[model samples]
Target: MGKPGFERAHHVAFFDAMATELPGDYDKQEVNHLTLSYFALGGLSLLRELDRVNKDEIARWVLSFQVHPEAHTDVDSGLFYGFCGSRSTQFPLSNVKDPCHNGSHLASTYSALAILKIVGYDLANVDSKALLQSMKKLQQPDGSFMPIHIGAETDLRFVYCAAAICSMLDDWTGMDKLKAKEYILNCQSYDGGFGMVPGSESHGGGTFCAVAALHLMGFIQVDLASNLNDSASIDMRMLLEWCLQRQVNDGGFQGRRNKASDTCYAFWVGGVLKIIGAYHLIDRCALREFLLTCQSPYGGFTKFPFDRIPDIYHSYYGLAALSLLEEEGLEPLSVELGILSSAL
Candidate 1:
């Protein structure tokens, strides 16, 4: 078959639905509204149609999630001043009086800043001091970051989020690069792929987080052999080989060993390969064909070709992966920040 046509109208409609009203199944994702918004807004950016959305209104809505230190002067004051995932995550305002239950999340904060940039908002108005202060508190002694200040998981995903936040803000004071590098190095599995934490199974998403975080922090060396002996050094060659191995014969990538190929891995794994300067080694034509198969006739993309419906996550990554492949009519993506290159 010929290359599948990009159903722009259908994809636009899909993003519109996500931006306006989510389906009933998305009830569980109510707390992650910011992330969902990022997917929709980011996808529109990739489609070069971000102007279709209300930039000002969306920017204001995103800013509302910012937890100001002055406003939240309770015991957990400075700790929760970044940005909440959604309004539902805000205490007092959401009638959630439990101070411990409501707080800013690293991932949400990253998405908020990314969407703001995507919508053409200037970061000068953002309280970078407050945001960075809150961000610093999320980092543990080992350099891994918890999604939130209290009782949250510490993993490579949050580490990437933290790095992206600092990179966008053009400030490194928010995190310790040496410690973060040590943590990332520790998370590398023997097989060369990275995991969520030390000694965990290697995963595509985690690998992207580790590699992208290093890239954003300026720790990635162009000369792979230059940093081999350093305590926090990454085995660039081995990691690149592991990422390359993720691509199956059909052109799609799997998250882990012996798993079925999925659409999102195109970004997760592809992003890693691009960071390591090994993207040229992948079968670009076959990967594109595999992603096209996952494209829904109605709109967006599913995790796999047979999935009945498409969600925002896979849909956005599908577009991003296509962008990495230099697909026609798509915006080029910043592999490290996971945003459109124009946004930077």
Candidate 2:
């Protein structure tokens, strides 16, 4: 068979189906429905097939998950007045007196805002003052963020989410920039890759979260692979090398040391390289071939190449990786924002 090309029409149909309603397998993830939609909607946007979705309806659906405080003063009640993951988590304000039980999440907030922008919703109407003011409550003294105000992990992931949320809203008040920067800086592994938290093993997702968070927070400069400036906070040379070494013989990128190449890492690792301006160094032909193997014949991508089924998460990152590679007919992405450039 000829070299597998970007199955544009099939992929569009794939995301279109998911956008209409996610498959039953995802029912267990009902709480994260908005996040799943971001992946599908983002995939459709990458394929230049956004016309398939109704912008107003999707925007309203996403907005419905947002949790606003009862009053402006409630921003200080230590509750996160951000977006919840889905309808189930959207607790009534009357029943949400406990900050810990409030269903709004940092990650969901990021996804909610992304979907809003994807649908061209006017975020100016969003309760920025409340969202930003309350989001600060989720930040710890160490500068990391918990996904929720309650029992949740604080790591580079939520930090990135918060940073993206603030960046999208065109306001930095949502997070303390200096503290977040310090927290992100502490995550860098000695090998030059970043971990989810200080003293953890380097990971592809964590590295992307750290780098992209730094980019959004203005702690690091872009295209460091080409510019090579001394003013950079992290070990630039080592960071670039660590990112470059992720491409294995199969041409797909791996998440961590000695791991199998996964579909999502293509975007996770490749996005870091792109931000550092080192993408031109990749084995483009081989990487494309590797990613094509993961393309599910039914549409979308799977974490592994031989997997039978497709998942919205891997599928979205697959398109994201292709967008980073500038694949023909796909929309370019804002790497840090994780959305269409036009959407911004």
Candidate 3:
């Protein structure tokens, strides 16, 4: 592929291929299916590939999965289900018709926004006010938000989701800023990285979420400056350094220590490093090579080196990694490639 025959490929085709190949297996159930599709379709839109898809039909499909605006589900127990493929008529994912559905997930909400925005849909079709209200109602006393109605484990990731939602809406009324910041700061692991929860294992994804949230809040630079006396500032810098070193000889990044490198973690880790002003610390050429290697001849990118199968999650992340590197030939990509260029 000298230059991608991008004009010939389309979003619907990519997603149909993925949906057919990776069905609703136990490991990749309906919820994950929606998550991956959201990312893939949204990624395509940002790449100007939506011209090939049924934008209206795909938009309708996404709206079908939304919890009814009139349902007025409990903020505490009613988790926003990811997406339903005609599975059941449940108000929410957790308790509706079945109990094993897990619950509303923060990741799903995040993915949903990205996908919708990519397709050029505004907040009009969604119960924007109600969803914001629900988000506000779900804030915990500890500042960190939970992902489900019954409250699954509280963590930094949800904090990021909550913050991103607020950022997208251009409002912070839904979150307790002071306490949310406190919780995010508290979750910084000793390794100079942040984790899902306090004192948990440091992960590249969690670190990016936390860092991006803080940056979006306009507190990162000043806070980092003011916290010069605080131990957390050192932790922040150390986290940046750790992320910078994640690039292997092949140019991809790993999520945690000792794990094999993957294309997606490049964005999770590299994007954070970029925000922290440390992206240049890595060997850009090598990382670009690794990401390029993961790109399928068909247009999408795989999760790891030479993995045959490719999905939206990896495809978007791979594009994002290239975006960070600003590779010579490709167009620019968003930090989360799922957010369409039009949305920005």
Give the whole-model CA lDDT for all candidates, comma-separated.
0.86, 0.88, 0.66
Question: How do the residues 1-344 of candidate 1 rate in per-residue lDDT, one tens digit apiece?
Answer: 57777677888888877777778787799888899889988998898887788999999999998877655465335465788897767775455466565568888999999999999899888999877866777789999998887767899999999999999998988898889999999999999999999999999999999989998898775444443433146777678789899999878999998999999999999988887667888999899989988899879999997576898889999989989999888899998998888889
Candidate 2, 171-198: lDDT as tens digits: 9988898899889889999999999999
Best by TM-score: 2
Q: List, residue by residue over 1-344, the lDDT tens digit for candidate 3.
A: 46332322533356446534554453445545457666656555545556766767767766666654335555444444333333332354444566445344566667666666666677555665656666765668888887755566888878888887777666677678778888888878888778888888888888888888877776665333343344334376677667876777666898988888998888899888766666667887678777767877566778887677666677777766765676543346556323634466
- Candidates, ranked, lDDT: 2, 1, 3
**Residue pairs with backbone overlap in model 3:** 76-149, 77-149, 79-104, 192-239, 251-286, 251-287
TM-scores for candidates 1 onward, in order: 0.93, 0.96, 0.80
RMSD, candidate 1, Å: 2.3
Global lDDT of model 2: 0.88
Clash count in backbone of candidate 2: 1
Candidate 2 at residue 25, lDDT?
96
Which numbered prediction scores highest in lDDT against the true structure?
A: 2
The ten-residue window of minimal lDDT in model 2 covers 223-232
